[model samples]
Target: MSVGDETLRNVNLVTMTDPLLGQVVEQYRVESLIGSGAMGMVYRGVHQVIGKAVAIKVLKLDYADDPEMVQRLVREARTVNAIRHPAIVDIFGFGTLPRSEQPYIVMDLLEGDPLDSYLKDHAPMKPRDVIPMLDELLSALSAAHAVGVIHRDLKPGNVFVESKPDGQKGIKVIDFGLAKQADRAGGSVKPTNPGTLLGTPAFMAPEQVLGTKVTPSTDLYAVGGIAYQMLTNHLPHEAPSAIEVLSQKMQHDPIRPRQWQPSLDEDLDGWVMNLLSREPEKRMKDADEARRALRRIGDGKTTGAQPVSGARPAVRTATGVVPRRDWGEARTLITEESSGVHDKPADVSTDRHVSPWAATNTEHPAQVEVEEATMPPQPAPRQKFQSARIEAPTVAANPDEVLAEVKKKESQRSLAPVALPVDAPGEVPVTVPPSRAGLYLALGAAVLALLAGLAWLLSQK
Candidate 1:
């Protein structure tokens, strides 16, 4: 259809059935609301067909009315369905209601508070405490990267810690809402305005902040930010504005992780710095290797954690305004206090432990909570670092520029249709059953090769 005709059809679209309720697509009952975003609301739903619980994300009417948004949502659903892994969010299927232009994704529902709220409530977690979390995050990233899905945005808010039936910990990384297919040269997301950021600024990698083309390594940079914050309750740094934070991420060197939490090990400090490297090429290229590093730490296999045979545990910071190493220790100790009401825990004590990666001070790590009553009415302004020069737009990003143009036209309330594939039209469905199709295919191919070889040998004889 012509762009003008498509625009008229969408402009006069009649509102249809509300999908947040029980829109029985493929036998799933869309029940209660779980969450909502700029795009649409997510519902806690159950599949009557399979008797399984799922989270259904329906595209918003405002966006669904636009052809570009409809295509974007469909692309996301297709990309997500293509990848299958336990660590990544599992997508069951996609469905479009009778009259809706866009589709919704059915996914596994995960339980947990956002990693940010969880951290703010429990900061200054021991270095050992953070290893397992990092291990899970890295494992998820590795699996996603293997399947050619780059989670452009990785932040504390996106990681969900789920409770396992057996009491062992499990994690699920969500919001592949922004994930891009690896082979695609351009982004599926576009900003209607130029120079406006498209990702979470605080956790976005330097390359992502610059709006430049990105690779798997870019996600690792954000992973580095999570590790850095975990090591110290405080961020390596913060800013009053998103653009300013992006500037620092793209240019300034972050203070070493151990500098904020002196108890952190030197090797860990180095690892965090390396992951947070401004240049993507310099960072850990593969998340699996980083996950292996996390495994060593969490499993008590890192050489630094070996117990000393003769040396006694040292005591640092016996009396002082808490050392830089113990910066957020006070805030994490108040277990019983409500979000806004509480004093620092006075019963706190440090392990006085030191390791190869551990930081050392002349005195023991401090154990004092700067009380809630003592805080100032307003927080102080964050120090800003000088931003670097913007590089020339690379040829690699020309397609992204086109996407941006499309997004600009999206805001006008007109839904223009782009050219569609004419020959093989509509969606082709593919599903993998629980049975091992790969194994069976391999066995069948092996039998065919063996028979063909025997036939050739017998004829020659």
Candidate 2:
């Protein structure tokens, strides 16, 4: 048998017996198994001398003989120790099991469940609740990043939530097994092999999915995903497999939080979306920036009115809003419909495309009605030709001055013979007129004829 197969066999044999229970591993006694996973098991332990509670995470037997896995466990302990933040679980000691020689890390014993479980029980948490937790989480991340430690595997399952003595929730960032110490040059101190994907797919930044270099912003992107889930109770990207989820994340931006729950604050939606940006440069610069933005959002000090650059515009569908492309073309269709320029209203029933912001939900009857009812009626078309009545200047007025004034007025009127209101609010009206009203009309007709001929020629091509 291969070494791996033999190691697996040994692990199975060891599982049949509880050898570590009540045994002293290093300076702590292994009391009970708190959890078990593919990599290892976490046990509740107490210091032999101090009697202080601690959590000991041991490497699985199959990986105990693997030097790389062993080093990774040791690296996690060193990384946490380097980042001495209160919100981060402290690792005080590292050792190996006497019988199995399995590597183990002794860290603080957190009292509460992981954030994933808390989210499941109280998802769609209010901004007030989520903001504080995020603040603490970001604070911890800021400290880690300051010390050049990047928690590459930041996800809800790695975050612990415990109630503090002050009646506030405490956030503890844990499980830095995938953490890397970045060098001064911003590259990983120990870079992974090219094309090796790290971090959880659901919360990974696009850079992580692409197997490219990761920066502090990579962790912030995961924070955005977590914030999104906390507010919406749904992952940013949901697919059957991890590969599919990664693919979706690479190709598309997550649906805006407001679309999932409109009652959410706009600034909160923007901040989360900003963090979830696919490009690292587009996301918050660091954890400090993210925390500050969160505070501003919570305080209503900033308006998130400007759409995030490079983000996919939300598509307006019959049922509800979804994230998609081709928004500009869809919006043009809405403007054309509202203008009444077409002899027959374009058959939107068969045309799936609609305005990105229009209420045209075809899937949900109730939403469609609500949107349609709230839509403002198109304004009446303005008169194209307003009589330019001119009055004779008083005889006492200088003829030269009168002539100059008349010329100025005529020039202004000729320039805007066919001014039209823009579809968007707050935009200046566009004019398509000439010097004289009659001449302007003639020019407009010629222009229209030319455009029609050009369009026909292109269609034939």
Poorly placed runs, candidate 2 (over 4 Å)? 1-16, 185-191, 303-313, 316-461
Q: TM-score each candidate.
A: 0.59, 0.65
Q: What is the lDDT of residue 447 in candidate 2?
A: 100
lDDT of each: 0.56, 0.65
Kindly list the per-residue Cα lDDT of model 1 for residues 204-275, writing each as its tens digit: 776665566777787888888888877666554455544445544543455555545655665576567668
Q: Model 2's lDDT to the true fold?
A: 0.65
List, residue by residue over 33-117, the lDDT tens digit for candidate 2. Answer: 6666667877778888999987878888999999888988888889888889999888888887777889888877777667776
lDDT score for residue 433 of model 1 = 31
Poorest 10 consecutive residues of model 2 by lDDT?
Answer: 386-395
381: Cα error in model 2, Å: 39
